[model samples]
Target: MAKCPEDLLLSGCFSSVALIMIKAPAPMLIAVGMYLPFDTTFAVFVGGMLKLASDKFLIKRNADEKQKTIVENIGILVASGFIAGEALTGVLLAALVLLGIPSITSLLTGQNAFEFTGSAMGGWLSILIFGIVILGLIRIPLGALKNKVQ
Candidate 1:
């Protein structure tokens, strides 16, 4: 009986949650990865401000909105839509990474890296570099995802 995906409960919920993440993942990464040498509660506050600025940029650009109701609602509803759309971007980024990395197939299957055997630092550095590269890889998908949801 649903007219569109918006009417379905599970689809709606997941999509909504994705919108939130899609909107401000960088702020989130910073909050989680860096201590910022200050009060942790301030992290949320900082994220909010960054998002506020993002929202303005989004608005100033004159983005095409399928639904007017969503623009007016702001806050949670709009945020969720962005996150939901970004989930697809995240998936795409993962795919691109797998294609780009020669050892991806082995890594996924639990085979360790060649450089990993060199030293303790080698293994540790590989993991660290991998994480950093993954973040960089995700940036494009995140941008694409933002456009899709919005």
Candidate 2:
């Protein structure tokens, strides 16, 4: 027989408590990541890799604690801006959809927009853009550190 939602909820609660008792790190985040879609999780994985790279970059540069803190702060601000911008853009697009404007380009050009989104080239373009964003994530903080020294 399939377990009821109450049973599942209780099981989850017990498991979480067990993990906490075991001194597990980020147990809740790990559990939530397990349930998230692959694309969402993959983005998180990429972010983790970027963070690793940033830490390595700082070590390679022999950054002082103050420099490291400055870079960390800049990185946090950049990440926050990215999150806010994505959320705002999503809200704006949803509003447009609710207003019966399906595609902004189509509204302006009287034709279907984003036809490339279904093609292989579109996939490659997405990868390229993702790479650019990743580079920005690494560079922007380090760049700020450089500017602060002058």
Candidate 3:
């Protein structure tokens, strides 16, 4: 006898959202926080906020049609870079696993990445990194605009 997907999904064992979340294209599902931990979801949310702030800056400056186009293009370029980077990283990690790389995560992080948690120092470091990336997203296009004026 075949089991129904909905029966399995809604049997009070799995949450409704989890049942509906995408299963294929795991990377995207993880990136969007549908099938992964909250940290990634939080990061993605913050990136959206950064884009919002960047758009606001452009509006505040009264950017013309061409300027608006340039800013939007820069945002797209940055987002593309992020997606490419994630894909490359995933491929590299997969290859390492296929090649029997020992303790790959530890090798990359000296096993400290997971241990350095719940500390103010770690929290501050995370904030600093997040700020830098967000600022870069905002500044790169603004810099381009400045160059155009020169």
TM-score of 1: 0.25
Residue 82, model 1: lDDT of: 55
Scored against the true structure, residue 48 in model 1 reaches a CA lDDT of: 66
lDDT of 2 by residue, 18-52 (tens): 88999888897677775788888887788878878
Which structure among the candidates has the greatest TM-score? 2
Over 1-150, each residue of candidate 1 has an lDDT whose tens digit, in order, gives: 747654566754665567576785554544444435556455355446645654565577665553222333444444455557679877866885777754553557655456555789887886786566444333433355465575
Candidate 3 off by > 4 Å:
1-4, 7-37, 103-127
lDDT of 3: 0.73
TM per candidate comes to 0.25, 0.87, 0.61
How displaced is residue 91 in candidate 3, in Å?
0.8
Q: Candidate 3, residue 142: CA error in Å?
A: 1.6
